[model samples]
Target: MSHEQLKRTALNNAHRQLGARMIDFGGWDMPVTYAGTIDEHMAVRTGAGLFDVSHMGEIEVRGAQALALVQHITTNDASKLQIGQAQYAGLTTPQGTFVDDLLVHKLSDEHYFLCVNASNTDKDFQWIVDNTKEFDAEVENTSGKYTQIALQGPRALEILQPFTNVDLGAIKYYWFANGTIDGVPAIIARTGYTGEDGFELYIDPNASEQIWNGLLEAGKPVGIQPCGLAARNTLRLEAKMALYGNDIDDTTTVYEADLAWIVKLNKGDFIGRDALARQKEQGLTRKLVGFEMIERGIGRDHYPILIAGQQVSQVSSGSPAPYLKKNIGLAYLPMSHVAIGSQFQIDVRGKLTAAQVVATPFYKRSA
Candidate 1:
């Protein structure tokens, strides 16, 4: 999409004022970097980095049949979730591939909140609506009601504590509490895309700039920087977090993507449960694997995978992981080639570059 026609987040002005380099991201005009990708990336690793994730979509399901509706669409078991808890789930199609990977939050006995990928918001909302015909639930696309921000890094808690009334220490991972941040009502969750101890805050659009500025001011002592999409990409890549359009999509199954952990076969008659069960029974032919470049080239998306100079699969997501200081990437390959320490080749610009399957999560926070 063109820049002029792209949608802007609530923080669009804030990012421009900070001299961020803006770019088109999934039809949204977003900041790609502030100081630079590498600099912003390192700041999040050592200190704290703020991100405007307001473009992500939110859907609300409310009524007596909310849990039933959620369980019918998502691969994860919604019944396993308690009030105030959240679970990672995949909204799957009848054919067993993902419509989108999302976070399902149990707000109450009869209320649920779904955080979906920015690009798949409308599609997901419609999918939920179409499936709700059998259940007595109300599905609303609440994407515009709030703006989201992520405060990530080692010092994230220290920077965010002063602005909220709730005790930051009490909120466990994957759990959230509605509280006031800088006197603005918000949903504060101890969840993040970066592999660090951090929090993602969902606040009213009108209050986003205030909260963003507040974080920057409060975090100044700890060297906080406003990061952008570029840094976010590298950070998540190093952490082995899947990017919806790249690492996974409608063509990839959860089991084939190495995300079987999110699938609960006992979830009971989900949209793709039967298809997934059959796939499991037959065993998987292809599997997603992580690799580091053995040659001095950076492998990228759509790059063909080869074994002994013959094509086998293709790279899905690849980047030079700044924190790990290595060229790390993920790809789908034959199960025989998915084993750790196994060697393969990636065609980088028509040149066969050596790469090897490596243990994922190239970077992990120190305990």
Candidate 2:
């Protein structure tokens, strides 16, 4: 699709006004960078950065059977979520393949919100509707009605404290609160994709511009930069976070993706619980691991992974770390080859270079 034909976010004009380089991100016209990728990445690490995340899907499941419906469709133990609490989960088919990864937030006993990936929004909504037909849950796609903005970094809380009346200190990680921002009702969650203290604000699309401007004005002194997808990717990679279509896909299983924590085998009978339990018993054949180049090479997506003398897997996502100043990447390989300090070779530009398997999380901020 052409750039002009792609979907635009509520802050599309603002991004353009900032001279951002726009690109196709999952069919949506989104900013790839403003200023520069490395500079934006460092801004989040040292200070705070703002992100327009309105392209994400917000789905609501409400009814008497909402809890039961969510428990059946997701691999996580939804029954454990308290009001205003959120948990990362996965929607999987009966064959144990991932449909999509999502975040389940329990608003009340009969109300729940699911933040899903943008690319799979339509498919996920249809899947939920088709599956919930047997139950009494009412599924609604509220993506178009809301806009999400992420204020992420070490100074995020300080920057956002002056705008809302909510108690920022009381709102712990993975918790949310319904409050007003400049007279507009908003749901603010103390969660973020980057491994830092931040908040995700969900507000009416019509009121997004006001809130964005308020934040920018409030953050002027703290050095809050408007970041784009380029910084988002690098920040997530430093935290060892997974990205869909790169780190995982429909063909990849939870066991192979090293996300077995999302699968609750004993949480009643979920769609993929049985198959995942069986896989656990049989042991995983392949697993994703973190690696760093020992020689001069920049690992990237789809790069070949050679073990001993033969190709075993491929790099899923990688980048030259602006923080670490080294090349790092994630890749899937045989279970027997995924040990700390294990030796391997990565094919960078048709030349094999030595690499070593290392512990994940290339960066972590102080608490």
Candidate 3:
């Protein structure tokens, strides 16, 4: 898509005012970095960093059969969720590939909220609607109704506590509270893509600037910085969090992606249950694994993997993990190549370099 066709979030002007370097991300004109990616990345690790995640899509499912409809479509057991709880799930096609990996928020027994990938919003919404024909559920594409801000890092709680009367401490991971943020209606969830103690605020688009500004001002004492997409990507990679388009997609099966935990086989019939069950019984051919560069070369997405002079697979997501201070990446290799210490060569820019399977989550915070 051309630059003219790129979508802009409510914080577009704010990012520009901060002199953030912009880039087209999945058809959205977004800030890639400000004050350099490494600096912003380190700030989040030691202090706090704010992110504009408004481009993510939201879908609302309500009505008497909402639970039934959600259970039928997603791979996770949505029935296990209680009000105000959220669970990571995948909307699967019957063939057992991901429609989209999403977070399902159980607002009530008859109401559920889905947070979907920005690029898959329309397709996922239509899929849900079409599948709900057998159930009495009302599915609404409410992506434009809210703006989301993620306050992430070690000092996030200290920074966000002053602006809301809602007891932020009481909200546990994967749980949310419906309250006002700076007197604006919001859903404050102790959830984040980056592996850290953080909260994501879902508020009206009109209140985005206010919340963004307030959080920054309040976080000044703790050295808060405005993070961009570049930092977000690196942070998530360090934590081994999957990026939809890169680490997974419609062609990747949940089992192959090492996301079998999200597929609840005994949760009663789901879209991909039968295929997943068959795959489980027969065993997997290829599986996702994390690897580190042993030689001085940075392997990147789609870079071919060679084992004993034969090309076996390719990289999915790779980079020099900022906090870990090492070059690492994720890839789908043959099951035989997935064991820790297994070695291979990565064809980086036509030059072969050594690599080895390593433990995932390249970075972990101190307890």
The top-ranked prediction according to lDDT is: 1
lDDT of each: 0.92, 0.90, 0.92
What tens digits encode model 2's per-residue C-alpha lDDT throughout 1-367?
9767899999999899889999999999999999899988888898899999999999999999999999999999999999989998888888787888889999999999999999999999998998778878899999999899999998999898878889887999999999987788899999889888899999999999889888887887888889999899989898888888899878888888899889888889888888888999999899989888899988889999998889998999988988778899899988888999988999899899988888988788887
Off by over 4 Å in 2: none
RMSD in angstroms, all models?
Answer: 0.9, 1.0, 1.0
Poorest 10 consecutive residues of model 3 by lDDT?
358-367
Pitting candidate 1 against candidate 2, the one with the higher TM-score is: 1
Q: lDDT rank, highest first?
A: 1, 3, 2
Model 2 lDDT, full chain set: 0.90
Question: Between which residue pairs do clashes occur in model 1?
Answer: none
TM-score of each: 0.98, 0.98, 0.98
Candidate 3: C-alpha lDDT: 0.92
Could you arrange the candidates by TM-score from highest to lowest? 1, 3, 2
| Model 3, runs deviating above 4 Å | none
